[model samples]
Every structure is written in C-alpha cells, then in structure tokens.
Target: MADQDPPKKPSSGLRPIERLNSEERLSRLTPATATATHHEYCSKFARDFLDAHFYYCSSKFVVARGGKVKALDEAFREAESWFSKALDWIAATEKIEIPLFYESREVQVSHSFAGRLLRLLMQYDRIFAETLYSLNCGSITADSRETTTVIAAKRIKSIQQLCIPDTDKFAPDGTLLNSSRSQTHGHA
Candidate 1:
C-alpha cells in the first residue's frame, strides 16, 4: 500500500492501569470497607445539622424582633431541606442489613449523627416553645422586654457570625436598635 496514514489510535485516552485496579477493588468492596465509606458520608452530613439549626434560630429572631417572618421562614425551609437530605442518607444506611458486623466507622458515624440531630431538634423545640409563650403572654415588664430584645439581637448576631465568615459586613448595631426604641417610645 502507498504511504497511507498509519491506522489512528482510538481517540479515547487509555486509563492508567492502577486507576482501573483501584476502581475494581472499590466495586468489589468488602462489608467493612463499605461501612467505612458510609461512615465518612454520614460524617459529612453533619454540616446539614448546623445549617438547619442556624436557619431555625434566625426564624425565631425574626419573629421576636417583629420583622417579616417570610424571609426567615424560607431560610428555615431550606434548612429543613438539608435536614431531609441527611435523614434520607441515614435511612439508606439503616436499610443495609449486615450481620456479623464489626464496629465499622459507618456504625459509629450513624450513631453520632443521630445523637447530634436529636439534641439539635430538642434544643430548638424548647427555644421556640419559650419564644411563643413569651409572645402570647404579652405581659413582660419593660425591663424584661428590653432584655429579651437584647438577647434576640445577640442571637441574630451570633447566627450571622456562624454563617458568614466576614462578620463585619453582617454586624448588627445595638445603638440603632436602642435609638429606634427610644424614638418609638418618645424617650428622646
């Protein structure tokens, strides 16, 4: 044959042999390895708990401060969405019926996640309940009201600091709150 172009190699590049071997091993994972993987995944899911708690506290602050609850409501909903994702992952791990189980990382992570979630939910529940009781009672003294306002403001500031790395940008001004309250009551 006259000088013809050499037969072209396939366009797809070859995968490294080591990578292929590793993937094969991963696919054929033993129970212990699988559990370890699950544990790692669950551990990562803990961030969702923090995010959800942050938003829930934000919602409470919004309500406490007489701000429009809609925005914070949406934020809380988003937190719930993250919590649902975590729950879904936990549920999947529960379905994995492994007998003769060693104390795998997955089992440890699962217990940790469960405990964290429970405590967070319970704490928020109590906070919300107390807030509602305070609101409905509507008989708090002026000093008590001022103290509550200050605490709510502090909580908002704390949550903002948690969620935003640059706290300065999101910082709340206690002076502004005080000025507004004074003006509203014709104190100054």
Candidate 2:
C-alpha cells in the first residue's frame, strides 16, 4: 500500500496557557468587572456541583455509602474547592490596590467584603438544592409530554388505518341494497 499521510491530530481551539497569556486575557479589568467575573465563575462552579449531586443520586452504586445525602455532601465539598480556587484567583490575579488613609473607612470596606463572602457561602446549599429540584422537574415534564405526543400520534394513525364499509349500493336507511327488480317490474 502507498504510504498514507499520517493521521491529522484534532485541533483544539486554543491551549489554555496560550489563551491565558494572550493580549485579550492580559488586559486589565475595572474592579467592578473583575468582581463580577469572580462571582460568575463561582456561580458556574455551584451549578456543576449541583449537577454532580443529581448524577450521584441517580447512579447505581455498589456501596452503602452512596446515599443521596452522602453524595450531596461529597459534591458540595468538591464545589467548595472550586470556589476556593476562585477566591485565590481574585487575590492573586485581580488586585484592587488602594492606599488607605482613614482607618475607619478601611475597616468598613474589609467588613463588607467579608460579609459578602460569608453570605455567598451560606446561600450555596439552598441554591444547589433548588437548581437540582428544578432541573429534575423540567426533565420529568419533558418526558411526559413526549410520551403523550407519541401515544396520540399512534392512536391517530390507527384510526386512519381502519377500513370503513363501502356504502354506495345501500339504501338511505342502511337496512337494504337498492332493488333493481322494483324499477324493472314497475316499468314493465
């Protein structure tokens, strides 16, 4: 056989490090934008974590330790790790450097930031549970709707396929055929 060209490697759109080091990525964000990005990343982590919880609950497990509550706890901890990474990214990459002149103002700012972080952590459990429940409900509704549509389509097809009796030779009352003999005798 003629030597075939070596199989081409599939191209991934961009290498992670290249994307990170690119000019667009290196461009500085306003503090507000940076804060929003941080929250967005953490929110994605929260959603993925909730999805994992649902998966675990649905999966067939060999061990007794794989109960829903246990699975939920495991998923929560994994998501928290991702959230921690986001926090670290904010600290290391998105610094909002400002010289503090007034001690009281600085104290207030610090307290507010801390409070925000704590509030987010507190909300995680409720948010995760709500997301899982909503997704489950949506899937169930979609499945039921699909089943109903298929059943209705089948019923309609069956009805259409039924053979109706031909009625061209029948009388209006449907008890007897139209008599050619009556017409012939009356005329004769």
Q: lDDT of all the models against the reference?
A: 0.34, 0.31
Root-mean-square deviation (CA) per prediction: 19.3, 28.8
Candidate 2, poorest ten consecutive residues by summed lDDT: 102-111
Off by over 4 Å in 1: 1-68, 94-188
Q: Candidate 2: where are CA atoms >4 Å away?
A: 1-66, 97-188
Q: Tens digits of per-residue lDDT for model 1 on 1-188?
A: 77899998888998546432122333343323222232211222233333334333322232232222233334444544554553343333312222222222322112222233333343333333343344345533445434543443343333333332222222243111222467777885
Clashing pairs in 1: none
The number of residue pairs in model 2 that clash at the backbone is: 0
- Candidate 2, RMSD to the unseen true structure: 28.8
Candidate 1 lDDT for residue 174: 18
lDDT of 1 at 102: 21
